[model samples]
Target: MSVTAVGAFTDEQLELRKTVRALLAKHADPAAVRKAAESERGYDAALWELLCQQVGVAALAIPEEFGGIGATAVETHVVFEELGRTLAPTPMLGSVVLAAQAILASGDTDACERLLPGIAEGTSVAALCWTGAEGSWDTDNVGVTAQGDVLTGSSHFVLDGSYADVLVVAAAVDGVVALFEVDPAQDAVTRRRVPTMDPTRTLAVVEFAGATGRLLTSDGAAALERVREIACVALSAEQVGAAEQALANTVEYSKSRVQFGRPIGSFQALKHRMADLYFLVETARSASYAAVASLAEASESAASDAAVAKVYCSEALQSVTGDSIQLHGGIAITWEHDAQLFFKRAHGSAQLFGQPRAYLTSMKSAAGLTA
Candidate 1:
């Protein structure tokens, strides 16, 4: 949705989005992005420093008392939408959506104080360690066990886990949801990279064998449930941005490429398709905003709303990004074009936390469906 249409972004929020867009335009060049995605680091550290140290995007979600902008969920959503447009290889989502949110939501003052500043300033990177074969976000799926503050068991598909200095792991201790802070350097932990469709965003299989960990919180299953809902909201925002970008690229390419005697964009069939793509993107954006607003309200129905947004947005993004590639014809299939990058990102992001089908099922159950 356009800033003008949203009508909710204050001048400051608009300005922040503009600034991030311009920064990405300048720094995340096509070549640079390709290189970062292929690199071992999985993201650009220098670009991350510029965002955290210079531009202050990383600090936007942190509370003002904790050395951040203290922006609300809606404002944070704007920032993530801009970030996704660039496909900037950074850990903004992992840090803010997973780590920072867990610490803040846990009501652990010591942990927040110890970790927030570093996360805000780009000195520290953290990953959310949860996900298994079913790729479930439910508390029971958390097989990693915490015993007397020590954590053990394996967490698969930990985003950014390979490079993070700290890991916020969700585990079950006698069926009670537990949070633990794991140091990657410790001897008890081992991390192996998982090759993914989108290399820019890293994933890893982390094994915690009697890993020494600091207890972050023990609020039972409720803590993990809340964190999962928050993650769904943030992810939906990113998918909206990805879908929008893919559509924009297709439009730009259609206008520039000539077919028959004129630009392909002038063709009636192509124009209608692009128009439909635009509508889908806008609908996804609206759904995403609704999710963010509901999350901010923390309503009783927020979880269901977030799940609906996630499922719808993921499906929309998959459709839009695929059509974006197809609309570009053979050129989109080549490695030189950026269309493939977005297509892969869309595919990968769809499975993060859980895929569209999983969310759809969860949403149905949340609505009290018997079948």
Candidate 2:
């Protein structure tokens, strides 16, 4: 379906999606994707400029007073959905999901003012340094330590950590959680890039030994709850986009590809499968939108809503992507096929806010289920 066919969004958002999709098509074509994935940096610098500096996608969520487009999370979701559709190689997830969110939610206006403009302008790259092993977003799980002005220990599975100029990291010290900024140029910090299931988005292990950092938030524990809320909702929205794209691709391919002298989509079996996937994607979208709406109200039920959306969307993306590849046949598994990219994105994103199993546990708890 064309982007405009999505009825929930505004005309401006539709135009924005169309423009960015075209930009990605021209700048991040197959060869460009291959080069970015194979290169040491894991993304195209020139294309980054075109999107962030010229196109203004990175600034979408930043307040206009701080050199941004002053967009809400819903608008940001639209931008990311198109990026996912094109599988564009950019740090949108890392920057917005991790760094920008941490800074914005930290309640450190000075820090936000100082850092966000550079991020919006594409002059700087920042990543949130946290371990996937931290599992859910509880601050008590933070293993990295910070004392005085120094931070120690390593953060594992850090998204875009290897490439970020600034690292907004979570750490614990004296039983208090804190957010610290680690400068990558400092010798006390070391980064090792890890090969990720999704090559389009870079991941790394960041080691800090007496790394000098500026503290941003003193109440890391409280801030963590808020940060996780934002991450979960934002991720849920991204999944909505990914799920939509996968279903659309699957349906489009099924309609065109022929077998036994007729379109395979005409087969009852495939039709049933596509129908199931469509239901899953639509349900996920509703859950995601509800969560986003709840977040805007700062509703006390935001955590539960976010959890529901996360779990639902995560499973939906996984199922939809699986069906997408299956429907596309063997061609989907090929490295050259866009289906593989969507597959990787599904796996990578599914685990970002804890796996579906973990969220399911949270969901059960939300439903008053006993441990």
Candidate 3:
């Protein structure tokens, strides 16, 4: 599919982005982010409530009937980008985007009606337990299995899994993948928080021992694929935003940080590097915007756009953050500086959903380019 220019943002979208940015600037500064990341819930509950109540961020993509703002992925993209800029740890990605989209894709009206309200309001958390220990996110590699209503086995790398009120699982059943809703509070269910390189995000391992689940969809491979595509697109926006912010911070530092006689950023070599980073950030932003546009429009090229956005944005963010560290010198690696946090976020996000190599391989296979 040929890449296209992103559509101009509507007035509301621009305003929404401004509102979210302002909120994050006020509430999720670097110190606040660090504090939240170290907290028990791994996020700022008060800020999350503010975002939900004021901006209606969690409700942006849900339909009106589901008690949402009846907006599109573009709106969610706006919010995700702002959240990425601050590396604010929140359930918006895992619960609002991943699990909510998975439930919507299941085409279970009753399930949507039952589950989406709390998610829309940011009052409840939901997690999608799909991948295994390998974190491949492949439909065929789903870790859990279902026999009748009972689920067994464990899923890893589950976002917000340790504290989610609802668990939407993709499990193998009779040789096919299906979606099941499991209550995390059930006696048969166990959740454990896992350590991660990125302190700004939370992941968990959920094990089910003959846990009873309510079937959402009997055939869920297609739904799972759809959710993955949407997730890739959404994540791409975050990567772009983070990359842009990283570059901005580096540039600002270059202007202020003096060397022997002048600012380090005034040096020709540093200027060139920053220029290259700028190019990467701009291109990645374009790719992310196009992907979100395609998804919002339900365009035929949405899947391919998502793939391109995921791979390109991941690489761009990683490259930007890596250079950011080098430019910032030893201070970048110190615990007191924010550069290290950006670097960690880049690496962690590159591995989230799936690695860039994984997406490239899938794209090549889909295009019949595989040997």
Candidate 4:
């Protein structure tokens, strides 16, 4: 069945999906992906610019008034899925989806007007630093403290933080958790590139040594919760794509490789494994699509939908990628193989927004179920 039929995608959205896939096929081929993975920015600079400028992907979900395409969450998910399929590295998720949405939710019109236009134009990158030591979407653990317009303390596991033009930090202000926007170039703001499980994506240690900030929202704790929910949905969409690609590659390898004068795919064991992976992929797709629909409608149950999507999709992708390597027997672990890339990406992404169990717990709470 067509994705549109299953996910309620419009005709335009289906076309958008095709266009995104074609673009990735041209620019994000395996060689380019490997080169980008080793590069300093962790992505093809030219491809990133092309996607942002020519394809206008960075502006997909932003409002038209803020120099965006004024698209919906469905379109955003479609773009992310294509990115994931190729394992393309970019700041669309960090700058556009998470940080831009946080700005809009902040009720700070001036911040939106000034910052969001640059984000839509692809000239600026932003990272939202919400998690601290605990690394689980908890506001109480946010170590940064805001003293008037100055921010102090440090945050870890900040995604895309090393290259961001703007930093939106979740900090405590006068005992209330709030969102603070800071310029990363400032002397007081230090960004140290941190080792990550996936070098295709970058993380940083951000230290605010009395760094000056512009308050984005007084109710930052709530805004960050919304950002976490939005991020979970986006991350899940990517996981779904990655998992789909892993299964496809594994199946193709099984069909091509020969053993005892027959294709390895003929083995009953391999067939059973592929069937199980297919089921997981489909389940993840359903949950992720449901989250996208809920987010598009701004539904009251969107949080629960996002939690379920994260838990199911992350686990599914992790499992798919792990088996993808095993399905290849040994070649999958070699330096030249692309399967390892997907495996590393899946491993890192599984813990990106929140781990599977954390989201599962949230889902239960949202559903009023006992732990």
TM-scores of the candidates in the order shown: 0.94, 0.91, 0.98, 0.96
Task: Please give, for residues 124-189, the per-residue lDDT of candidate 1 as tens digits.
Answer: 888888766457767667758888878888888887788889888888877777787778899999
Off by over 4 Å in 3: 1-4
TM-score pick, better of 2 and 3: 3
User: lDDT value for candidate 4?
Assistant: 0.86
Q: Highest lDDT: which candidate?
A: 3
What TM value does model 3 have?
Answer: 0.98
Comparing 1 and 2 by TM-score, which wins?
A: 1
Candidate 4 wrong stretches, greater than 4 Å: 1-5
**Cα lDDT computed for each candidate against the true fold:** 0.81, 0.80, 0.92, 0.86
Candidate 4, residues 1-371: lDDT per residue as tens digits? 12331586778888888988998999999898888978887778788888888778888888898888988888889989988998988888888887898998888888888999889888888888887777776865687898899898988888788889988999987788999889898999988878888877778889989899988888987887888888889999999999999899999999999999999999998899899999999989999998888888888888888888888898899999999999897899997898998999999998887778877776678679996
Rank by TM-score (best first): 3, 4, 1, 2
Task: Give the per-residue Cα lDDT of candidate 1 at 6.
Answer: 44
Tens digit of lDDT per residue, candidate 3, span 1-371?
12235548878888998999999999999999999999888999999999999999999888889988888888899889999999999999999988999999999999999999999999989999999888998877789999999999999999999899999999999989999999999999999988999999999999999999999998789988999999999898888889999999999999999999899998999999899999999999999988988888789999999989999999999999999999999999999999999899999988888889988888889989965
Model 4 residue 54 lDDT score: 77
Error of 3 at 272 (Å): 0.8
Ranking, lDDT, top scorer first = 3, 4, 1, 2
Give the CA lDDT, 0 to 100, for residue 154 in model 4: 89
Model 4's TM-score against the true structure: 0.96
Q: Which regions of candidate 1 deviate over 4 angstroms?
A: 1-7
